[model samples]
Target chain A: MTTPTTGLPPEPAGRRSWLRDHSELGVCVMLLVLGALVLTDALTMDVDLTQRGPVGPRTVPVVVGAGLLVVAVLLAVDVVRGGRGRAETGEDVDLSEPADWRTVLLLTGVFLGSAVLIEPLGFPVSGALLFWGAAFALGSRRFDRDPLIAATVSLVAHTVFDNLLGVPLPGGPLMGVL
Target chain B: MNALTSLLDGFGTALTPINLLWAAIGVLLGTAIGVLPGIGPAMAVALLLPVTYGLEPIGAFIMFAGIYYGAMFGGSTTSILLNTPGESAAVVAAMEGNPMAKSGRGAQALAAAAIGHFAGGMVGTVLLVALAPAVAGLAVDIGAPDYFAIMVLAFIAVTSVLGSSRIRGLASLLIGLTIGLVGLDRMTGQQRLTFGSLQLADGIDVVIVAVGLFAIGEALWVAAHLRRGPPEPIPVGLPWLSRGDVRRTWKSWARGPFIGFPFGAIPAGGAEIPTFLSYVTEKRLSRHQEEWGKGAIEGVAGPESAASASAAGTLVTMLTLGLPTTAVAAVMLAAFQQYGIQPGPLLFEREPDLVWGLIASLFVGMVLLLALNLPLAPVWAKLLRIPRPYLYAGILFFASIGAYAVGGEVIDLVILLIIGLIGFGMRRYGLPVLPAIVAVILGPAAEQQLRRALQISDGSVSGLVGTPFSVTVYAVIVLLLAWPLLKKAVTRRRAEH
Candidate 1:
């Protein structure tokens, strides 16, 4: 039978190994790791007599840690029982297409690159690169138009946010040149 | 009568030229972004939240009220023409409106939706004006225990009511709670998960969590599966209803608010259920049974009204109890907290101008929406033709600006990217993002309330259930948890018969 709830195409029975089928196990593992980290942190935390109530700072974290562990186990059980989650759908999302990892990776790299360079290169130069990089990653190939638009977008953002809105942004080598 | 006078005074405040200008700008920007595929009202508000940093609290909230309502109004345009819902609440509108568009009645469908939205929004705001004060009046007596119980109910309700799997929902919530656990504990000032970072001591900013999750996460997710080529929007002439169309839709519009407003006021009672209920109710009452699945005006009319009305209803809970039942409400609540304005019973007395003006501005926003957007439908529809690359790139660009603008530090941007990845993972794994956001917003508050409750009773658990209100809330929570089992048992019994 087709998985109506999950909106996934029906899988061939016994064609793939069970391990491959249960890719969601990764999520469970992540949850378990997080739970352990929280538990370790909460357990090791020092509590002086500053706490007035029986429910001190550690209580909520401990409870939350236990909850994460419980939820991880429960989710693992559900996944093994042939349950599947329906990936989120949106207006731009095409569920029929396999995820484009290259684009996601490129976008991530661009984002991180901007974050690293924002302070040193300033918002205008870095942000312009960020916009162009993201557009290229998303498949905009108009080399002539894209950079022009990106530079314009970055400058406009700088002007509005820095000058108009009065929220300061670093200008770097081009400081006061604009 | 008191609410009426207060509302009138609110109108006086909202009508000031500066406040009106902000409202108009909010409506314009909100609708423009809301019309874009993959961006909903919540994302619009979250992306715009940082820009309001320089404004006073009153203007910011007034603008938010405009944005909130304006986005809902804009969502239907995309739903009707593009056959893609801007948000979950607009799904019902797309069901019939898309069919109507396919049948070459796109304008009629849009007219019905727009007018129906106006009618429902008006009713919901009136009810909000009337009911919010009464609810807040009663809420004044609610102790920390009762508040804690309500928060628990909200958490459980959001988890249980949404998504197919309870395990995934709970897991998402736990992740949010863990994130919320970072920073110095409210009571003892001891770090729970800060890991000795100076920035972590103050905790992750709600602006980061909000923009990172809603805006940046959405941008990344869309980038991964970006649809090739521009969407083909159904062309429509100016939206104008004939006499027959209005005659058909007015009844549904009238009936929709009654169905939508009460549902909106309740905790975790989002627009989805009420809109669905309105659609079903209209289908049942209509004489055109054959058109049930086809392009039915009543179908669009009812659900559109319900959705708008529920938006107002969601605000009721947000204003009266400081509880947010929908994603948009949650982000708006964060916006309130950003300004150090705690919305609840006391807000009515403390910030009457801000509160009342915000409520009155909802009406002003509706007028602006109908007056401007009705003729501007084609302009909004054209927004869909913008290439997916620039749309998503703009989102990331603005998100980065918003995040960095918050603290003027690179660390905030790093945190933003990390949260964006988690958000992307949540979507990939079919985890509902709403619970996570609500948890992030309410987690620390709920923990504080829980501790205070226990402290009042000297660490006895009975303090949690001491009040009748809290006790009743606990009973509801129990019922919410047991519902799935109850439903399964009923189905099995029926099968045996």
Candidate 2:
């Protein structure tokens, strides 16, 4: 991605260089947008004449939003001056390897799918499917044993939650037993 | 004498057959979960919080006390048996503990670690019993201005002490404060930032934030970096120490709690600092100088005791001042909120029986951890062999349940998913997750106190620094903010020279 000076004329390049160096400019932009939003929201609140005080609900929001803008500016300058936090390196795994994007994308799908299906399908059915789908996402191929375990886990969770703990879980088709 | 009588009565509550059974189960499960490859005690506590949702507060807290200490005891076992430490504090343990394991002294290392935990937990709990009431008394005298000042202090400490850069930490905190603003304004019943959405009018739930940040976020991050295969597990047996080993560890255990307690009692205290400090203390003071870097039994013993003692010390501020210094404490604060209980000075006056009972149970839970972990060390180590696919999938399943069970809204699941993805990005970018969660829980509280202080002074700006206590606190905050910049400049000058 670096070493890309080939495609452009290089006269007024300091501006581009500053932006490029400040890669965390995106976070700065986000902060400014959020600050604007908070200001917008705080200004739009209905004026309650009956409730007058030294401070009101809007005071803290305004202070925090303005603080964020100042922090964003400082952070951007720091980035341009070559300050950056290092990536996490754990003792357990090989961080040298690029992240397995395939597995990550699949797990994202599984979580999203479960969120959509959970209410309609109920806890037991959605829970089992979530279990099985996540296992697949993480590279499990034991089709026979995985399904059986997922079923047992989901059903047992249903029983323990609904019956034992007294926190009611949705029972779906097996509502009678669960 | 009154405190003693109440504590004894607390024992009567904790010693009941049903509560004892729950304590046993809590410690046992705490160890099992804590032994997972990457999961720490904080993550374990956060994940398992929902299980006690339906129980009465007394029994639920009895179980939580066990889970809290049990998980800490269990963290060291994983460090000794596995290359990766589950908790940051246990990283020091793995230094000496793993070597001891490889050298066929795994049993000895486990014994030292377990016994160290017992000593630390006992002493720490004793101090808690004595100091908590005194601290609560002091806290009662503090007014709204002081309370707001301390909350601001906590906010600064939490953000500045965590993550790589202060700016990122502040950013995460701002995001949390924005989220906190979504609900109806408590005083005037005015909606702040709900954007006409009724679901948001109640504000975001802390449980969803916790589950997303710790459980689902961690699971997804691990999956994204899924290792080619499972880590090779080190086999071990029941923990037992040699005579000489026992003699070696006794002094270290005695010293560890003294070093650990004050650190954990401070706001924004982290478990990692105390453990590392313990390791260095032992290294400097050890008789066996040859074993400094290798498998020094003192290394395992000192850090483990400090780690446990600090865990107990964290509870002091949490229960008395309603300030949480660690990630697990923040989540536990959310748990108290779930029960409609606010832990502060009034907590002692309003619910003495419950408070005493919870403290008494910590002692019981410590004993239970020692009894269960020594014989079951081998059994818990075997849990490390569970396939990654099934393990993480199961985590997601449980995390989803935790979110859905809270108010039973599908929209909560959507919040969890979005927050989980953001958590993933936070992890990837080295933006710590703890600050965000802490800010979310404490943001509303700080604002409430701020307004109360202001109302008392009729909107005078100087009202915030009204009391000498608040003045001192603000001075400390200014010092804290300035120290980092001054240090940076000193280093730069030194480098130039």
- Candidate number achieving the greatest lDDT relative to the actual structure: 1
True contacts kept of 2: 0.65
Candidate 2 regions exceeding 4 Å error are A1-25, A48-51, A89-93, A176-178, B486-497
Q: In model 2, which residue pairs have backbone atoms overlapping below 3 Å? A: A54-B459
Query: Tens-digit lDDT track for model 2 on B344-432?
Result: 99898888888988899899999989988888888888888889899889989988888887878889888888878877767665567
Native A-B interface contacts kept, per candidate: 0.82, 0.65
Q: Evaluate all candidate structures by whole-model CA lDDT and list the values in order.
A: 0.88, 0.82
Question: Which regions of candidate 1 fall more than 4 Å away from where they truly are?
Answer: A1-17
Minimum summed lDDT over a 10-residue window in model 1 chain B is located at B262-271
Chain B TM for prediction 2: 0.97
Q: Model 1 interface RMSD, in angstroms?
A: 1.9
Q: What are the clash counts of all predictions, listed in order?
A: 0, 1
**Tens digits of per-residue lDDT for model 2 on A91-149?**
34456687788988888888778778866777888889989999998889999899889
